[model samples]
Target: MRVAIVHDELMRKGGAEQVVLTMLKAFPNADLFTLAYNPEGTYPEYKNYKINTSKLQFLSRSVKWMQRLYFPLGVWAMKSLKVHGYDVVLISNTHSAKYVDIDNDALVFIYTYTPFRLAWEPTSYSQYVESRGVYRWVFDKVINYLREIDRKEAQKGDFYLGMTKETAQRIRDAYQVEDVTIIAPDVKTVNFKLSDKEKEYYLVVSRLEYYKKTDLAIEAFNELGLPLIVVGSGTKADELKRLAKPNIQFRSGLTSEELADLYANCKALIFPQYEDYGITPLEAIASGRPVIAYERGGVLETMIPYRGDASKATAVFFKEQTIESLKGAIELFQSLNFDPEFIKAHAEKFDEYVFIDKIKQFVTDKYRKSRQKSSPKPKLASEKRINS
Candidate 1:
């Protein structure tokens, strides 16, 4: 069977992009499709595949520019994609890629990170765009238009997959769809190993973005006067750096090995954001490190929260995303004793192999069911004759 994998765009190295790469591994012969591909911005491994892009690829190759154009032009670009000669089309979509046109007979499976957040969740989207007065008026118009389009596009999928229960609920609410299968994103557990080095500083492995709540970590670390190593870069990088005290240091563009080293030796990973399905916490846990995360979103499902059980806990939960809540969690973390082996073992549950197996099986079963429905059934021999 000819399989095709469609992603919104291959523009950056994030959790969604990583999932697309994993899908490619599962279907090695599958053709990869996207709206755009920026080689310098995305993972280098994608170069190994013959990535097919829409007309948008010719307009601009800038990752930042492409991201800015996502809402306005993404729907059109996604809809422009005409995927033919495929038995199954697996869409790894966080945005408009689910709109891709496929053969009517082809089984379309959408692995949604969440329904288009820009259209459905205005508060979260406001962080990325200027939303006040005239801008807000225009934003509202654009969002309303996109919401209709997003919902309509969502109906194209034969099956739906969500990374977490929270995201599944979001998908169901946004598209008014049912039965969203929960498939948690994976981490490369074997790639990370616990180091023998001293745990000297706290770690924050997230994009420096407003929605990510990286600022909360900076504020908390600044007040605590503890050493924090922020390992990411984004539009908020300069602003986050300025907000941070000398105790908080910023680093970016590190290799996997370099990141794993930091994860291994860090006091604990500080996750301030409410992610759809966070991968960093799992990565930190795989390095035999405990996480101090905001008690919300996918982390609640992934990390075993500390509720007076240090032996079973893999993380200390902060009730709020505020600085004080994070600081309190940090203090609680310092007093607690975590078993490194236990933490590592917990992370292994979300290993990449497991994710691959689940995805492959799901696709196989769905494809078989689709084929069975389409195939002609034998005619009944003893049917009642209608009066002429």
Candidate 2:
């Protein structure tokens, strides 16, 4: 079957993009569609596919700013695209990809990382804080308008695939939609390898965003006087660096191999954010390293408590997201002896093979059902005459 895959944007290589790549692999002949495509030295595999971008590409250098403004516009543009011939359309969305227009008869599968949390939790640290100005007012108005549009689009989709159980619950609450499936994110096992060589420093492998809580890790590491190596960069990088202590080291933009090495070698991976479904912690665990994470959201679902003998957990969790809380957890982990084999075992559950199998099954089942409903069967002449 011909397939069309839609994504929020192809501006950067992140967890969402990884999911899209997995979908592409599942349907090799599928054409990719996105709002923007700023390759900016991304995976060579992306170049092999037919990626169709929206008119937002006209922004050129101002692409980032345009994303904030043209989000709804991108959705509207999808209606103009000639995807009617495609048997299935799969959307890998963190944002507006859910808003794509498709045939009512087409098999539409929506993979949601989060149900637009920025719209629901506007005051959350992850959201863009705007100052009192014309731009701020306009931004708020636009965001509110787009949020309603997003909700409408979400309700129209054939099925919703959530990255985690927590995300499924959130989507149900936010959109009042019931047909949702929980599909955990996949990790590329080949990218991460187990290492015997240990490092004293803990690793924080995430975008240096406010919502990521990189600041929390920095503060905790500084207070504990522990060596902390941060790998990745984002909007908050410069400000976070200013707050960094002598013990904290920041490295921006590393290849997947380099990141996997860091994950394998570090004493433990520190994930301070309450993420939807963090791939980094899983990667660290797959590399036979335990994680130190906030005890909420997807982490609660994935990580087992480090305390109970009956409990089988791959990581230690902090009750609070504060620096003090994280520091205490780090110290506790340092004092305890964690089983690396157990950690690796837990991570194995989210291996690429499992994810691919589950997704393939879901798509195949849906496609079969769609065909069964649409296919015309041979009719009896008597029945036909009666109908006439």
Candidate 3:
């Protein structure tokens, strides 16, 4: 079968980007499509693939600038992409790449990270943008326009594959469509080969962005007066650091082994963000560290919370995305004793083997169904007689 892979863009090697990489590896012969590609910004391994990017890639100079143009020009550019030759198109995306024009007979399965957050959950997206001074009346009108188009495209999808059940429900609500299969992303469990030594400090692995609520984590840790180490860097780093107390530490550019060691040593993984499907928490769990996460999004599917049986729970949940909730969860985490064996085993459940197997099966099934759809169904003799 002629297969193709479509991603919204490649700017960073995040969990969503990792999914695209996996899909590309799954169909090595398939052509890779994107609105943009930045060799410097994302994984270097992506250069090995046969990539086809839109004209708009030139217009979207930087990763940050692409955010503003993605809705306006990226949507238009992707919508006009002529994906006529491919028999099966597996789109690993969160944004407007879903609206690409493909052969009517082709199986267009959207392995979605999310329905565009700006379209579906406008509040989180807007609050950040408005804070940056772009959320004027003109911007609201443009957003409304984008949301309308996005909703229309959502219904046009042949099938939807979500990373979590929570995302599936969100898609269902946003698109008013059903048949969203929950296929979670896998982590490279082997990379998290860590020692059994537990450390005093807790860990935070994130992009350091506003939506992530890293600032809130810093505030919580400050109030608790505990050692908190935040890994990774972004635009919000300076601001987050300002909010942080002496107990908080920021470290960037760690090697894979070093990251694993960090994960292994920390008391627990702190994930303040509500993500489509977070891989960092699972990686920490694979490293035999329990998670202290904001109890929403994909974490809900992965982390089994600590009840009376601490050995059974892979992680602890904070109810609200507030400093008080996080502080309370951290205090609770200090009291509990987690089994490393249980935590490691829990992470193994969504390993690369399982994820690849499921993707292969899903794509094969969808391809067969698509072919069947293209073939004509026969009418009964009575119906033929009536026609005559």
By lDDT, who's the top model here?
1
lDDT, residue 99, model 3: 71
Measured against the true structure, the TM-scores of the candidates, in listed sequence, are: 0.94, 0.90, 0.91
Over 4 Å off in model 2, which ranges? 60-63, 66-68, 71-82, 125-139, 309-312, 374-388
Per-candidate clashes, comma-separated: 0, 0, 0
Q: How should the candidates be ordered by lDDT, best one leading?
A: 1, 3, 2
Candidate 1 lDDT over 150-223, as tens digits, reads 77777777789999888999999998788899888888898899887889999999877778999899999889
RMSD per model, one decimal:
5.6, 5.7, 5.2
Who is ahead in TM-score, 2 or 3? Answer: 3
lDDT of 1 at 109: 90
Models sorted by TM-score, best on top: 1, 3, 2
- Please give, for residues 1-388, the per-residue lDDT of candidate 3 as tens digits: 9998888888766888877777776777889888888887777789788778887788887778787687678888888776669888888877767777776556678888888877666666535466545546666777789787877765546678898888888788877777899889988898886575648898999987768888888888888898999998877889888888899999987766778889989999999888878999999999989999888888888889888899999889989988889889998989999999888999999888788889988898878865666555544432211110
lDDT of each residue in 72-92, candidate 2, tens digit only: 555565444444567888888
* Cα lDDT listed for each candidate: 0.86, 0.77, 0.81
> How large an RMSD does model 1 have?
5.6
Tell me the TM-score of model 1: 0.94
lDDT of 1 at 373: 78
